[model samples]
Structures are given as structure tokens and as C-alpha cells.
Target chain A: MSGNNDYTQIDNLLREDRMPHIWCPGCGLGSVLHSFLTALNKSEVPLDKVSVVSGIGCTGRTAGYVKLDSFHTTHGRAIPFATGLKLANPELKVIVFSGDGDIGSIGGNHLIHAARRNMDLTVICVNNFIYGMTGGQVAPTTPLNARTSTSPYGCFDRPFNLPKLVTAAGATYVARWTAMHVRRLEKAIVEALLKPGFSFVEVIAPCPTQYGRKNRQSTGLAQMDYYKENSIIKHGADTKDVDIDLNGQIVIGKFVDIECPTFYDLQTEILGKTFPHMSKTQAEEASA
Target chain B: MSRDGQLVGEFFMNGDVASAEGAICAGCRFFAGYPITPATEVAERMAERLPEVGGTFIQMEDEIASMAAILGGSWGGVKSMTSTSGPGFSLMMENLGLGAMTETPCVVVNIQRAGPSTGLPTLTQQGDMMQARWGSHGLYGTIAIAPSSPQEMFELTITAFNLSEKYRTPVLIMSDESVGHMSEKVVIPPMEQIEIFPRRKPTVPVDEYLPFKADADLVPPMGNAGEGYRFHVTGLTHDERGYPDMTAEAQDKLVRRLLDKIELNKDDIIILEEDGIDGAEVVVCSYGISARVALLAVKAAREEGIKVGILRLVTVWPFPDQKIKEIAKKIRAFVVPELNAGQVVLEVERCAGGAAETILVPHMGGAVHDPDVILEAIRKGSK
Candidate 1:
């Protein structure tokens, strides 16, 4: 970087006025967002045609910090909101950026449904393995035997295998990466953006304040070192084998990539049969 | 008129179906809802009809999703709506607050069923009156219209959209099971005759625009996603620039604006129908099916020389405080007949300010109030 005072390179894509974001120091959201913006720049989509929608969380704040037309919506509602945005104006590129607790726990219903419908959109879930915004509660993705504010003894319930869940629900593209793998994450994001159907990317991030402190890695730097030591990049690995274990290896790579007709494509195909009264102009409108 | 799939002639239809036609004629192009009893027909009609007009329809996983989707659709620059009953309306409360805080314009229809929980599903009652006003929580005000007939359902739905667009808030069409299921003749007016209120757009250039900045009307001009104005909106309390402001001072400004927009323009937004209220000693204050039921009681009481009048509330929110207070001065009593156990009567009693005796004639659920019970209340109230 040329000067500390300058942010001209990324300023076009960021709402710098809303800077000094609320994320704690050592949090990996900044780098995750960096990867996203880099991928956004490389994708060549027009800025005006893009919209970012986020549910309630620390990561949901990404919608506000981004310069694009964005919506910081209610808790656990980002997926359905993005679905509506895409269906209403089929031409706009709707992106859902939120957290594991928001999307995987409370929003789990909407996430699976969107995947099942094969809606065309991209979702980035930053997973820190705890509910960071609400002071580190046990999350749907918290590993068994991990300790949280709510699970002081240990989490007894099994956490979600996000890749297995979404892939089974019919997502066309799925990938996972850690904050340590910025280049790979950026490249995966670009590919997902170009994918035609539901594309999801889970970025295992460092929450120095919450999950890291409970586990051995108390600092964000320690969490990054843990990722460096534990993560294994295995592209095209089966999703069923990607469950995160408390003391085991972290499997990180692109998991599922396939093809299918999107929700809009199928909806447009059955227009005349379902909506028999469609006019000539309306046909083109729905087909958009 | 025919180009947009607007039905331009009269047709016999149920109130639920009439509501769907009204949405189409009012330029609503997107509908998101889940099927529920008493309100399912509205979604069924929209599924078949919205696609005909180039509108989009999606039955979400639940009412919560449905409510969130329509708010999303609204920011996408399309007028959107949803229909549900008591159970679904309860699920939609949180996102309804989201719509209020963000100032997203949309319509919600609740065909009331009786209950504190799921009292009577297939039956009719004028319940959910107070819930429509305060169900979503917070200190914001909402606009709700009561339709007593299928024709009024058609007309008031159009009014709902107009007020929503004009005020930039969620407008509720608080009809109940009886009117929603009852069939009647509804006129589909020509497109030109229908007054359409398009969403107000900010006239400023993109660089110069602040998303939540209010124009002279206190309601800000909204810009859609792809309109080149990169604006951000949130359910969190925000300043005029649409950035989240956690301070109470900022919140004070935001909440006051959300409420004051409707308060300052109450006269333009409220609609009331009154007959013989001027010289009457007793005025029946009612809405929705209760209003229609009161008609019979009012006539019967008038026949007995009680000088009773019917004050039908078309737009029920902002409480019509001034009008009720004014009318209370001339009338000896304001008798309220409702299917719920005294909801809207509370508002009447508060607005009456003890100038007139406000008597509540309540029926629990499953049926309308008998005309005689209301007549008895009228007689008791008149004394």
C-alpha cells in the first residue's frame, strides 16, 4: 500500500464513511471481505446490477459497509430476502453475506429451502464456530466437546456439516476455505459468482474474542496458526467426509460443482401452463 | 386496462378474490405468501393472476419468510403484498417491524379468525383489531383499513396500496373471515379511473443522495437497487444517510419520523363513513364485519326512535382520535359492537375522553354479534 491515508483502490467498492466497523481486533471478517471484494472486482459484474443482502450478525454488517445497493435485514432472513430480490428483478445479482449462527442455525430452514429450489444467487457464510454477536453462544456449527457461553461444560449435540447439508439440498456449487487461504477463497468466490444456481462458500474465520478464547487459540494470530497447521486442501472431496471435529483435521476446498436448471429458468419454462392468462408482454417480463 | 391483466368489468367474487383483483389494479406486481385458512384464496388467486400481469408469486416456507420476501421485493422497486390469518400474522410480526423501521412500502392482508392463539380457524370474528395496530412492537404507527364487503375489499385494498406508497409504511387490510368468504358483486374499474400512487423517488442525483433523508413530506423518496443510487437500508435504527446510529438521539429522530409521517397526515389517510351522526344521540363505532352487523342494529334502534347512527371506520389506524373526540361531544353515547372481547372499544373509550359514555358490546368468537345484543347495548348506552 502506498499510504495509510489512502484507500482509493478499494474505496470504489466500499462505503468508507461507515468505516471503523464494529468487528473486534483479530477478527478474520476483514480479510474474508477483502477476498470477497477482490472476487467481486474480478467477476466483471456491473456495480449497479449487484445487491448484497445480510441477516443480523457481525458479518451481516458487510451489507452496510459495502458500497453496492445493500440490505441489512432482520435476523435469519438473508436467504429469503435475497430470493425475493432475485425473483423480483431477475437481472440483478443478489448476494447473501452473513454468519454461521445466522444462516446455519436460525436461518437453516431458509438456507435449505433456497438450495432445494436451486435459486440463482451466491451466499458467503463466515463461520467462527460461535455466536460472536451475542457474546459467544453455542452455535449449530460448534464442534462437539467445544465450550461456549451457553455450553460451559461442553456441547453435546452434533453440529451441522454445512457442505453435506447444502449439497444434499441441491446446491449446484459448494466450497469451504479458511482466512489463511485468501487467494484460493478469492478464486472460489469468483467461480461461484459465475455459477448459474445456488452457490455457497463457507469461510472458517478467526473469532479471537469468542471461539478462540474458549479453545487453546486465544488470539486471532493463534487461530490463524491453527488453521495453517490443521487445514488440508482437498478439492473435489466428498461432502459427507467434511464434518469438522474438535481435535481432528480441517478439510477445506471446493466440494460440489454441477449443473441444473435454476428456479427462474424452470419458472419461466412452465409459464403458459401455470399462468394461462399471461399476456405477450408479461411472458417476456417473467422470462427476464 | 387489459394490457396489465387488470379486470375492467364487474364480476361476482368473494372478498378474498376481490382483494387479489384490487392488488393487480393498484399496480402491485409481486406477491409472497404462505397458504393459511380463510386467507388461502387470496394467495390462490394471486398465483393464477399475478403471472398473467408479469407479476411474481412465491409461497414461502412460512409467513416469516413471506413477510421478509415482500419487503425485499419492495426494495427491488415493485409493489408487493402478502395475505394471511391470525396464526400467520403472528409469525410475521418481527419482519413487519423490519418493514416499519426500514420504511419499506408494502401491503399485508389479515383475514381475522377468532383467538388468543388458534381459537376458531374456519369461523368469523372481528378479532385482531388491536393486534393490527400494535402487534409488531416498537413505537411506530401503522395504517389499517377495514372492509365490510367484497366490493369494499376491492376498493379498500387499492386504498391500502395508495396509503402504503404515500406514507412509506406497511398498510394492513384488517378484514375478517365473514367478509373474506362472502361472495358479492365487485366492480373492476378502468385503469384510468383508478388513482395510483407510485413510490416517491428521490429527485437528487446518486452522489448527492442520502437514502433516508426526508423530503418536505417527512417520508423520504426511495431509490431502488439498480437505479445507480447505491443506498443501504437496515432494520437497525438509522440516520438519514441510512447508516446505523446507536445513539438515543439518532433513535429519537428516526422513531419520531417513522411515527410523525402518519400523524401529521392523519386527515389525508383516514377514511370514515357516517350516517345520521349529526343529530344522533347514540353512534355505533364499528369496523369490518362488525360495522356491517351494526347497520342492522342501527336501523332497528332508529325504528324505535333512539336516534342511533353508524360510524363505519374505513381506515382504523391513527385511531381517528380527533374525529371520535369531536363526535363524542355531540353524541350521548358511542356503542361499539365487535366480535372480539373489547379491543377497538379501548381506542374509542380513550378518544371519547368521557364526554360521552363508551359502551363495548363484545362477542367472544365463532359468530357475529346478534343484532338484538347490539340493540340492547345501544338502548343501554343511549340512556
Candidate 2:
């Protein structure tokens, strides 16, 4: 491999030929993917044993671009797929990356349950607050009264407080950061990668063509400026206080970081005692 | 006992339990499912056995997740499976389609129940024959097996995993609630004796590996997720390299091959039980629980001096088209007895091609057809 052809340090970690990605102009997914690859590099997690999974949406495209063992599964089904992957092969580290609509809406049940069961996975939810791939439809995380193709009259329903939901559902590690905080995003991902149990880092990204255009933050810079002006980092704040409204102060920080027996720990503890001669694989210590 | 979880001695067990044991014997190490009537025993049995035999059994939130997880498990270097009844089966269709598209090797056991919206949750029905064949959105070929009894359930669950592994696609065991609930003797042989088909591991090196590229047998060997293969698979149409190629040509190539893998191998995949079909005037064609009923009916008709035969479909999908067409030439009529109105009969009729009269002995759930009803149909068909 010629160093001259390698454009970036993390180029080895990505499918460069697949780039010029599908994310539109000024979309924040590019920055998010960069930070993710950076984290994967710095953490030194064996890329061979790392399987990246994603659901449908713009963010879901991350699985395809990653040079790791990847699976671009059906819409809203990435969590379950990752759960199976991790459980079936306890040695592999599974990561789920998808959009707000994919994880917060259609896959809401799976998201909460994975956290509840404390499945060993690092979930990176790229929340642009709109379904950018499908022409900017209203998302579950879209602010109430936000304009979208579907919510033309404005969204009447309240949006999901993702951080609060996952924390309550029992995530051992949880954090939120916008795309502008690339360094911090990369750091948090590294931390989440190191931490076992269900680790979630929600990356608030920009959808220039969709959410930004509809919600009046039309350009990618506009969304970054909003982040620049309104962002407040208060570590360990009450998750309930982190809900972001339209043009609201973006409370971005590590919200929940605690110790808990993960799905594997509990499985081993409980099953090892009962089935004295059980196998050492992930599924060996399971049942009900 | 030496086989760890394989029970070789004769034991009276329900078909559901036998299936769970069969999965264990067939090298399935991961099971994920949700509880549903009649089929719940399969999950219950799996829960007890998987832990004992060093496998994973998870009760997922629902069937869709159950199906998705199994696919994930399969890629994670374990043979995986999920079992459900009617409602759960319908919920699983989307992911099942995804499983087919990605060519993931997994087994889905749908213990048939009455449905059209939970029609008869506690009862048996062969209602999902068409759904099993065409429930998924796109045009993809399906491999479905119909187990008639507890013994067959134990035997065929192994076959389902073997077929799924051989083809690198999800295989369905379409047994009804009656058969799923029936208790009978299931003799599991020594593990060394059972023909086990391991996952086809990729022969090519990592850089040269194309995850979706078919080898000589039209099935690309699979490489596990963490093996440095670093391959990608998607629900979208993809090329040989496992990268998405959004074009009509790409779709045509992928779908046709995804289909031809099973279609071309139909002779190897299709299993049928034919008795007296060589010179019978009328053929009693059936599968699953209905086939059990059709057998007695055929016997009764024979006593009445009617020339009839019994053709029980063991492998329901890739539907014994050639065999059906061949039999149609000599038979006066084909008597199809299914718990549903007419599902597989349509395929029988299509294969028969007006060569023989096609008669459907239909039952609309809650119960199996009486032998007398099928007997009357067979007697009339022969005349």
C-alpha cells in the first residue's frame, strides 16, 4: 500500500473505494464516522474480532463503509442482530450504529431491552432528529412542532429522550455529543469501547438536506453554530434535564457511568453455579 | 450421554421436545425464540437442553427479533434457530426475507397454528403453506420441510439445519400444532452416526474472499464474523464482493442465483414418501398433519377396491414439481387433503397441468380432516 494514496490515517480502517459516501453535502455523518474510526484505532480493539452492525437510514450506511466485519441489517433490527452476534460468539465485540428513527422509533423496544438486559454492545446512535435518507420525514426524536414532509402542520407528539430512556433501561455507560465535538466524541467512544455492558453514545448530527432545511438550520455550518452557541457540558447531570428542544440549549456530556453486572457476568455467575460443567462459550451460560 | 446432550435411548416425548433435541444433535448452539401456544414447548425444551449441552437459548422480545438474532448467531460461528407459531411466524416474515437475502444459514421452526389474525391459537392448521412459500416480499426461493410426527420432527429438525447449512439460507420446518403437540417415541442415534453437515467454510483467502460469490455448488462458503475476513452483507441487492449494487442487472444476477442455488439443488433438497404411486388410479397428496389423516383415508379407499396411493411430502418447498408432473400422467385424479382451504394444492394443480383432475379436501382449522372425508374424496377420484 502506497502512503501517497492514503489520504488519512484511518483510511486503512475504512472502505475508501465506497467513498464519496451517500451522505449529502454538509451532513454530519462524515464527521461522526471519522471519530468512530479514530476511536476504533486508538482503543486498539482487534478489528478482526469487531463486528459493526447497522439498521436502515443514513446513519445505517456506516456498516457498509466500515472495513470491519459488518452487517447492514433490516430497518430497526440491528440491536437484535448484534445481540445474537455477541451472544453467539462471546469473544467478538459488537457495535450497533444507526439513526434516530431506526433506534428510537421502530427499534425502540429492542434498544430498551438490550440496555435492560445489559447486553455487551457499544451502540452509537447518530441522531439527526429527522429521517434524512427518506426525504426528511419526521422522526421519533424530532422536536415537537418541528416541520417535516410528514409533519407539515408541525409535529404534535413529544420526541423521545434517548439518553434518559437508555439510562433508565440500565445502560452502564451513556453519553451524548454533537458532531462538532469531534475530539470529545472520539474520546467518549474510546471509553465506551473499553467499558463493558451496554454502552451508548448518541451523536447529535446535522441533516442539511432534511432536518436543517425543514427546521431552518439550513446549512451544516448553521447546525454547528447552533451547537457552538447553545452547547453546555455538565457531566453527570440528571438525564431528565438533557432533553433538547428546537433551538434549545444542547446539554451534551456523559450522563450515566456506573458499575453493573453485565449480561455475561450475570449469565456466568448464575449458570456456572447451576450447570457446574457448562461450557465456557457465551450461550453455555444461559436459559430460563 | 457421551454426546453431551444427545439422548440415544428411546423416549416418549412430544414433537416439540424432539425438535429441540434434534437441533442439539444437529450442532445448533444458539436458539432464540418467543413463547407462543403449542410451539412454546419447543422453546421450553430448548431452554432446558441448550444450557445442558453448552448452547445459548434466549427468549427474545418477539419473533422478528428472534429471527434476526438467529441470523446474527449463525454469522457469529454458531448454528442458530428460532421457533414460533402462527402470529410469531407472520411477525418473522420480514427478517426471514432478510435472512434469505443475506444468504445466512439458520433454521426457523414454525409450529403451524390457525391464523388469519390469530384464528385458532390453540388448534392445528396447515394454513401457512403459502405464507411459508411466498410470505417474504421479494421473489426468493424457500426451502420448507413438513414433519408428520414426533419421530419425524426429531429426524427432520436435523435435516432442516443440514439443508440450511448446505444452501447457506434459512430453512423452515413447517409442522402443525397437532404434530408439534403429539407425543411419541423418538430414537436419537449416536452423534457419530447422524449425518451432520457443517457450515461451508470459505476456501479462498481473506483478500480473495467474496462473501456472496457462489462456488461450484452455487453456494459461497461462509466465513465467521471475527475471522479477519471482514466481509460485509446487506439486505439490499449486492454484488459478489458483498457490496451493494443498486441496479436492475445486479438485482437480476443476485436474485436469480439466490433462487437457483435452491432450485438447481431441488433434487437433493426435495424429500417425498411415495407408496403405490407407480400404478395408482388416484393419488392422495398431502403433508404435515393432514398427510397423517390422508394415509388412513387412502388405506380405507384401498379396502373399498379403489386403486389409490399416498404421496406424503417430506420436503414441501422446491415443491416436488418433477415428481408431481410425472405422476400426473398416469393418475386419474390428485386428492389433496390439507387443514387449510387450498395452499399446496395450488402447486399440485400447477404441476398436474390438467393431466389429472385436482381435488382439494379442505379443512378450515380447529381440527384435522376426518379420514372418512379424505377416503370419500379418494374413492370418488379413483372412479
Candidate 3:
């Protein structure tokens, strides 16, 4: 099995028996998974040490396909679940991979709080603009005036600028890339994986079956072309200035990177100072 | 260094505090909860003590997140628990179903208070008894243990953790506000004397392991998140391999196993205490604080030369149906007194199966039953 030519590199990281996956033909989720696999392969962290968590949605299925310790948690709960996983075993590299509605709308509170605490988690959010799995419901990331199942008249609410949300919430590292930018997205993922504190990467992906068809980008290829034409690589750009518009210029780049003490570090420091007589492990163990 | 060793001692404390200590003694190392009245002391105690014992205590944004965190913590290879009262318990229902579906081992302590919607935050009520059994949406079996006093709260919380680990399901410590806030002497036995059931881990190598495959005992060996087992856990109906299988057949198989894991083990899970039940004319059935009150009523009835017995339910769910059936054959009737208008009495009535008359001495929350009222019911049942 070691020298087998039958298996592809990406295939080694996937649950081959579980494929072909549930994703529609030409869905951007496939590309996102590929980029994640590529990044995992490139990173120095051991695959065995990685744990992936996801909330309910089309993207939530990513945890099921990945041949790693993964949790397909309840809707709007991936971040908190990952927080618990990481805090319980600090050695594990916990990552939350879910859709826009999952991470931005219902789970928005956890996202901000996890980022605010600077919990060491890698959050890879696939922003498909609409809630694809629930049949194209309007999401928090649905661009203004966009058509959705719920918003047949057009979405009137302004969409959240995710990079700005996490930046303000105190994420140490943040970046954005399109699913079509496979190489760049993979690189961003690798960088996010290696970063110390809470890191977030927003991947702008097409939901051809849901968002794309409803909005006039009809085919996955058409959405990819739009991404290619509209995306502007703006490293160090202000997150607040990167709000996406329908078929408009998509500002994509690494926007924030800084150093700060994480939740675990601060907690340890406080416990150590408070209990001077106890060893670090003992102090940590006292709560168990 | 050994936190478990430090747990052996006697202390006079409230039920909520004793419960937190019980969780630690039971080898629970992770606690995630939101602070709610009556149950908040459990979280406060955990926050103060967990770090000292090499454990983790996290106060999540809400009960929903708290429930999710404990499930994640369990998968991360820790015995996890969370506590809440009525409102927070309601918020935790959805994720509680997820825990059941995924077969995660964790404990949920509901220091129950009066509620249709937070009617009485500081008052005692067994109103959430039915909710604990069926709060989470689905047809599933659940384990809930009722503790009558602070000492029982300490003892039964450990039982809750042990049962959760053994069955790989969420166990509920269905304590009420009266017991939660009341102080009493609780003796923590030496660590070695207390039996703790740790989750079963897969013996097979990573390649051969199936995440949802159950042994003859109807429980799957759990694989920790970062242990290289690389298993997938989902709330969706899944095959033994843990991959989603959305078919009626798959749902039937998965749901049945989830139910059977506890149902088949019902004999072991049901815990009840009885006094003077043999050859009794009337048996008073009750649980939680009401059980203590019912015992006094039984004593009053017996003093009046009435043949009455007391059936105290320690494990409220898995409902002691067999015991009720056996006792119903010899008894003329059952008198159930509860804080709620009617809850567990329905279960007693169902199990009696017309062999005996079932009477409910109802109380509309905010207080325990007056012994005279239950005594009246016992006297009525005897006649």
C-alpha cells in the first residue's frame, strides 16, 4: 500500500469510501476541501494532532469527509465545540470549518467570543453568500439586494464584513480568498494553521445550485470567472473597506496579523500567580 | 498531584456545591455551563475548584453553547458536565439531542425550579421531570436520577457521571431548588471506595475501528479527538462507520440502538427504594423532595392503622416500571404526591395497568407538598 500508484495524494486525506460526496456537480466546496487538504499536507503540524469541527450546513459536511478526528456539531455551535476541544487538550490543533449562515448568523456570538478570547483555533469560513443546504435561504453574508428563497423580493439587510468582524473581535491573524484562488487559499490556510492565536480565513465560494443560479452567475464556471475578474489582491487592506457587493470588486488578502497572549496563556498566568505554592500542572488540575 | 485523592472528606454544604464536588470525585475534568439561579453555585464551585485539580471549567455564552462544549469536551477525552435550571435547560434541549444522537458521554444537572417560563427562580418544583425525559426532540431513551437531599445530591451526581460513561449517553441529575439550596452533611467516601466508570476506548487499531460500532453491551468504544483514530461524529443518522446514511432503514437502526442501549439496560439503570411495600394496601410513589415529604405522609397513615408503604424513586427515568408492576399486584392503590400538578404520576398510572388505582396528590409548584395532604391521599387510597 505504501508505493501504490492507485491512490492520489488528496485521496489519502479523504474518506474514499464515503465518496462521491453529496456536493453538487461543480460545487466550490470540493475546491475548498482540496485547498484544505493541500494546506494540511504542507503544514508542519502532524495530521493526527488536528481536529476539525463544523456546524450544520453544506460546508459542515467537510468534517465528515476529512479522514481526521472531526465533529459535525449542532447548528451554530462549531466554534464553542472547538473551543472546548482545544481547551480540554491544548495539544490538539482545533479548526472550525463551516458555512456563512452557520458561522456568521446563528453562530455569530460564538465566533466573536472565541475570537475575543483569542482562543487558539483556526476558523475556515466558506462564504457562499446564501444558505445553500437549506435551499438558498438569505444568510448574514447574503449581499444586499440579492435574491434568495426567503428573500424573493431581494435581500434588503446589509451583509456582514467577516474580516472586519474578527479583526474587531481580536483575532491575531485574518485573511480572505476565493475558492477559485486555490493556491492562494491553500497558502492562507497553511499560514492560519501555523499562527499562534485565533486565526480566521474567509473563503469566498460559489453555491451554483443555490446562490449562483438565483443571482445570474448560473454556472460554477461563470462564478469562477466572476471571481477571477472581480477579486483584487489587497494585502494589509482595511477590513472595514472590504464589504463584498454583488458582482463587484472582491477585496481578498491577509488583512491582520499581530501577537497577543491567548486565553490559555492568560488563564495559566492568572492561576499561577493566584496559587504560588502549586505547580503549573497542579493548578490547572485543581479544577478537574 | 492526585486530585481524586484529595476528594475524600466530610463536609456540610449545599446540594449545588456537593454536586460540583461529586463531579470532580467522579473523575469529571471538564465543566461548561451558564450561570442560572439555584444551579449557579455548581458553576461557581467548579470555576473555583476545577483548576486546582487539573481540570477545565468554562462558562459559555449560553446553555446551548455550554451543552455543545461538554459534548466536545467528552470527545476530547474528558468526563464533562453542565448544570442549569429551567430556562437554561430549555435552551440546552437541541444540543442535548445532538449528544444523544452522537452517543457522547456527559452529565446535565438540572436544579429544577418552578416554570412554565421561569415562574419561580428560587422556588422548588419537579415541573421539569417530564421535560428531562422528553425535552430533546426525538424518540429516545434518557437517564435521569432524582436526589432527595444534599447528601443524595453528592452521591447521585457521581452516579449520573458513571451511568453516562457506561451507556455513552447524557445523564440528567434531576435535582430541584429545595435540595439544591439546602445545606446538609455530605460524606465523601475515600476515592477507592467510590467506583468510577470511565468511557470505554477502542481496542482495535485506527484502521479497523468503526466510530459507531457497538459491542454486545450496546455501547461503542469512544475514540478521543486527537488520538489518531481519525473518526467522524455527526448528529445525523449514521452507519457504524459514522458516515451519514439518510434512509429509513438507517434511521431505524441508529435510533433503535440509541433507545435500546438504555432500554435493554433498564434493570441496571432503574434505582428505587421501598419501605413496608410488601402486603401493603396502599403505596405512596414519589421522588425528589416530594419523596421525603411522602415518607412522612406514609408514616402518618401507618400511625392511623392504615397499611401504607413508600416507594421513593432515585432513578426517575427508566421509570421503575417493573417494580411498580410487581408492587401493583399486591397493593390496592398508589398515591403519588409531586410538586408539579402531575408528571411522574402518569408514569405510575401507566405502569399500574389497571391492576391498582393511581391517585395524584398535586401541588402547583413554589413549595413541597404538605404531609397531611399526601396522608389524606394515602388514607383515601387505603379505603
Per-model lDDT:
0.91, 0.92, 0.91
Better of 2 and 3 by lDDT: 2
Candidate 2 structure quality by residue, lDDT tens digits, A1-288: 223533237878889878778989899999999999888877877889999999999999999999989999999999999999999999898999999999999999999999999999999999999988889899999898899999999998799999999999999999999999999999999999988899999999998899898888999999999999999998998999999898899999999899898888787777878887642534443332
Model 3 local distance difference test score: 0.91
The candidate scoring highest on DockQ is 2
TM-score of chain A of each: 0.92, 0.94, 0.93
lDDT of 3 by residue, B196-286 (tens): 8878989998889998999998899988988888899999999999999999999999999999999899998989898898889999899
For residues B1-383, could you state the per-residue lDDT of candidate 2 as single tens digits?
Answer: 66576788898999999999899999998999999997999999888888888898899999989999999999999999999998999999999999999999999999998888878898999999999999989889899999999999999999999999999999999999999999998898898899999989988778999998899888999999999999998999999989999999999999999899999999999999989988899999999999998878887888888889889999999899999899999999999999988999999999999999999999999999999999888878977
lDDT of 3 by residue, A154-226 (tens): 9999999999999999999999999999999999999999887899999999888998999999899999999
In model 2, the Cα lDDT at residue B205 comes to 78
Kindly report which residue stretches of model 2 are placed more than 4 angstroms away from their true locations once superposed: A1-8, A277-288
Cα error of candidate 1 at position B150, Å: 0.5
Alpha-carbon DockQ of candidate 3: 0.78
Q: What is the DockQ of candidate 1?
A: 0.74
For each candidate, what TM-score against the reference? 0.97, 0.97, 0.97
The interface RMSD for candidate 1 is: 1.0
- Candidate 3 regions with alpha-carbon error over 4 angstroms: A1-8, A276-288, B1-5
Going through the candidates in order, what fraction of the true interface contacts does each contain? Answer: 0.73, 0.88, 0.77
Q: Write the per-residue lDDT of candidate 1 for residues B96-146, one digit (tens) a residue.
A: 999999998999999998777888898987778888889988889889999
Quick one: best lDDT, which candidate?
2
Docking quality (DockQ) for each candidate: 0.74, 0.86, 0.78
Worst 10 residues of 2 chain A by lDDT: A279-288
